[model samples]
Target: MATSTEHLIDIDRYTGELIQGWERIKQSIFVILTTRLRTRLMRLWWGSKFNEMQDKPGNEEVLMSSMMAAISAINTYEPEFKVTRVVIEDMGPDGEITITVEGIDLVDEALRRLKTTI
Candidate 1:
C-alpha cells in the first residue's frame, strides 16, 4: 500500500502535467492580431499578460502575418464595413472553428458576400 506522502507526490506530479497540457490548449485558442487594431484589442483584452503570449504563438510572427492578410482582405473586399463588435464564438467542434461577428446589419451583408464568394 502506498503511504500518504507517496500519494501526495503522485498527485502533485499529475497536477503539474495537467497544468502544462492546459497551457498548450490556451496557446491554440488565441488569435494573433497583427495590425494596430489587434494591438489595441489585445491591450484591452489582456493588459500585462499580452507580452507573455506574444512570442509563444510561433513568435507571434507568422500569426501576425496571417492576421494582416485577413485585415487586408477586409479592407479590400468590404470597404463599407461599419463593424461595431466582433464576436468569435466557439461552436464546439473537433477541430473546426466558427467565427461569428455581430454588428450593424453587417452580418447580413457579410453572409450575402460569403454566399456569392463561396
Candidate 2:
C-alpha cells in the first residue's frame, strides 16, 4: 500500500498544477466579468474627481463607499485573487482610504484590465 506521504505528494502534485491552471482561469474569468468594471473603478478611485470629492466629508464617505462597492464586487467574484496588503494613506474628511492591493502580478493584471477600458 502507498504510504500516506506518497498519497499526499501525489495529491499535492496533481492539485498544484490544477490550482495553478485555475488561477489563470479565475483571472481571465474576472477580467471577462469585470473589465469595464475595473476601468470605471480606476476612474472613480484615481480620477481627478476623486480628489475633488475630498473637499467635503460627506462626499468622501460616498466616494469611499462607491469604491468599496467596486472592490467588494471583485472580491465576491474572484476569491482567489488574494489581496496580500492594503494601505490606508489618507482617511481624509471624506474618509477616503487609499487601498493598494498586494501581489504585483495581480495589480498588473488589474491594471491591464483597466487599461483596456480607459
Candidate 3:
C-alpha cells in the first residue's frame, strides 16, 4: 500500500510513472523474468534467460534449474528484492507459465509476495 514516488516504473506501459509498493516489485520481477539475457545494452548478464527453456522437455529438473538461475540472476539486476522463494507453475493445459515469488523489499524492509504469468 505504500505509494512512494521512488517505486519502479512500469515498463510495459507508456506512462512511465512510478508504480506502487507491491505492484512495483511485482512488475519488476515480471520484467526480469520476461527479459532475454544479453538483450539489454551494457548489461549482458541481466535477465532471466527463460528463452533457453523453450523447445526443451518441461521436466521438474529443467524447470527448477531455470528458476534457480533466474532467481539468482534477478538479484544481480534488482538488488532491491531479496527473493526467498520462487514457485514456477507450468500450466501446460492452459498454455501459460506462472511464477510466484516471495521476497523482502530491501528499500522498505517489508515482505512481499507476487505472482505473474509469462
Candidate 4:
C-alpha cells in the first residue's frame, strides 16, 4: 500500500502531528464537501454545490441533488477515495441534513466512512 501525508490544518490542536493515508483522505473529503464552490480564489473549481441546497425545501428532488453534488465533488477532488455509496438523510423539522459517504481508500485499500451534517 502507498501512503500520503498531509499537515493537519489545526496544527495547534494536533501539536503538529501529520495526518496520513486513510485519515488524510477522509479529512480531504470533508473539506471538499463543506466548502462552497467558487469561494476559493485560486482553486475556483474546487468544492461542492451541496451548500446551495440549504434553505430550500428538503424534498426528494433537493435531497437527490445534494447527494449528486457530494458525489461529484468527491469524485473530482479526491481521486484517491473511490466513492461507493452516498446516503443523505433529512433530520426532520429543523431542516438539517446528514450526509454519509462510504468509499474505498485507494492508498490503503480499506473501506472508510465519513458522516457530516449540513
Candidate topping TM-score: 4
Q: Let me know the TM-score candidate 4 reaches against the reference structure.
A: 0.80
Clash totals, every prediction: 0, 1, 0, 0
lDDT of 1 by residue, 33-117 (tens): 2222324554543212222323333434644443344334343333233334333233233422234322222322332111000
TM-score, per-candidate, Cα-based? 0.25, 0.28, 0.76, 0.80
Candidate 3 lDDT by residue in tens digits, 10-111: 543546775655666666677787888889899777787765665557788778777887678667777578888888766454446777888878768778
TM-score of 2: 0.28
Which ranges of candidate 2 are over 4 A from the true structure? 1-58, 84-100, 103-118
TM-score of 3: 0.76
| Superposition error at 65 for model 2 (Å) | 0.9
Q: lDDT score of model 2? A: 0.37
Comparing 3 and 4 by TM-score, which wins?
Answer: 4
Error of 3 at 12 (Å): 6.8
Which is superior by lDDT, 2 or 4? 4
lDDT, candidate 4, 3-46, per-residue tens: 45432332222456766566677678878887898999999988
Top lDDT model: 4
The order of the candidates by TM-score, greatest first, is: 4, 3, 2, 1
**What is the alpha-carbon lDDT of model 1 when measured against the actual structure?**
0.29
